[model samples]
Target: MSPKILVVLSSHDKLGDTGKQTGWYLPEFAHPYYKLEGKADMTIISPKGGAAPLDPSSVEMFKEDAEASKFLKEKEALWTNTDKLSNYLGKADQYDGIFYVGGHGPMFDLATDSDSQQLIKEFYEAGKVTSAVCHGPAAFVNVKLSDGSYLVKDQEITAFTNTEEDQVGLSSAMPFMLETKLQENGAKIVKADQPWGVKVVQSGKGGKLITGQNPASAAGIGEAILAAL
Candidate 1:
């Protein structure tokens, strides 16, 4: 049987403020969804049960990209009816891996939610690949392993960087910076040329934990996860 993977999305709706443009970027989720959907039995879930928000800017960009445009119009059901994370936490062992999709929104909720932290721990301890991209790595900030250590500590990984955060003008708006926090916790951080550059890092003999720099790296990240599986 093909492996099953759980794709967790951010539930945050506002960006900086309620009226501003911020949420999950369309391409980030679409590219990976396309790559993994058929090859793996994939299930999309969110911190909240329904209606995952889209960053307005991403929606505009998608309108211009044919693939993304098609996804937006045809995958309406996925966006409108995401499974709640709470419902899946009890059944995490059913999946082969867990992937956290990125957006500024994850920084707002994924990092601190107790349920999210627990899910990460459960998946990691079960020997499943636990992967994330961009600010999605923020969710790892508080995930504790069976030994009581942060799951990411001393692991070589990459995420949306501090410099990129400033370039995007979100450095001041985020609850906390991802790169800084990851380093402070003992991760040996690796990065690519620019904030928007596509990059991915995998660590462990089985390549069990994976991370990507940003949305541009989502496809590569998905490939890595599939390979590991």
Candidate 2:
């Protein structure tokens, strides 16, 4: 059977107290979906399992990318009706991997949702590929392995960096610094040369942990997941 991939998104739409709207970044999902579509069966899910909101800026960014536009027009059903994160916590064995699409939103819900934490732990401990891009790595903040150690402990990873967060002007608005939290949890973090640079990390052959630096790393991370699978 083709590998089954679970794509997780954040249902939260508010961007801190800034009063701005946010959710999953469109191309982060669109780029990866298109790249993984034929190779794997993907199910998009959120904490509440309804229409996952799109970051307004990402929607605008989609206009310049043909792949993202194609996904928007043709793949609405997948993202519109997602499964509940609660429904897959114990049953994650059905999925060969999980991919988290980033946006300012994940920093709110996915970062601290108990169910999301449990699910990430399940996938990681099961030796299944666990991939996240940009703020998607927010989901890793509180995940603990079966042995009670952080899943990211001693792992080399990357996410939306502190500098990039400040560059995007959301530094003060986030609940916490994503890169700092990952570092606190013992991740040997590496960053790219600049804000939008692509940085995809795949541990080793058949390695289960995969992460991308920012939006620019989405497609590259998707390809890494395929190879890991």
Candidate 3:
């Protein structure tokens, strides 16, 4: 049987009162979804249960990207009609793994959502794959395992870096710095050599905790997830 993966997206659309619309980054989800499509069956879900917002900037920036464009047109319903994350909380057995696609939005919602945290904990403790990219790792910031240790605790990981956040000039707008929070949670975080460079870290029990540095690492994160699975 094909691996069944649950793809989680952020429901928050507002970008920290910056008056900018933000949601999941297009390429971050787009690239990985396609990479894992034939290999794994996926179900998309979010906190709000519908229309996982797409960051406008990511849409505009990738206007010419064939993969992103194709995904938006062909798989629009997958994102726009996401189911409720809460519905899957105790149903981790249905999925082989869970994946998070990053945008500034996850920093606002998924990071603190109790349901999201619980689901991650269930997956992690069950020895299942748990992965994220860019701001997606924000969801890991507050996910404590059964022993009260943060899920990222003592794990090697990577996410949108503090420098990249500042470079993009939205550091102050975020509720907290993602990379810093992950580090504070005891994750030995690493990053790419340069901003926007592709970097994916797979560490934790059985290397099932996979994370990517930025949008550039989306496909790599998917590849890592497949390897871990």
Write model 3 residue lDDT over 22-93, tens digit each, in one string: 999999999998888899999999999988899999989999999999998898889888999999989888
Q: Rate the local accuracy (lDDT) of all candidates.
A: 0.85, 0.89, 0.93
Ranking by lDDT: 3, 2, 1
Instruction: Order the candidates by TM-score, highest first.
Output: 3, 2, 1
Task: Kindly indicate the candidate among 1 and 3 with the higher lDDT.
Answer: 3
Worst 10 residues of 3 by lDDT: 220-229
lDDT of 1 by residue, 83-149 (tens): 9998877576899999988889888989898998999888888889999998889999878888988
| TM-score attained by model 3 | 0.98
Superpose all Cα atoms of candidate 2 onto the true structure and report the RMSD in Å to 1 decimal: 1.3
TM-score of each: 0.95, 0.96, 0.98
| Deviation from truth (RMSD, Å), model 3 | 0.8
lDDT per residue as tens, model 2, 154-227:
88888999999998888999999999999999999988887779899876226678999998998999888888
Backbone clash pairs for candidate 3 read none
Model 3, runs deviating above 4 Å: none
Superposition TM-score, candidate 2 onto the true structure? 0.96
Clashing pairs in 2: none
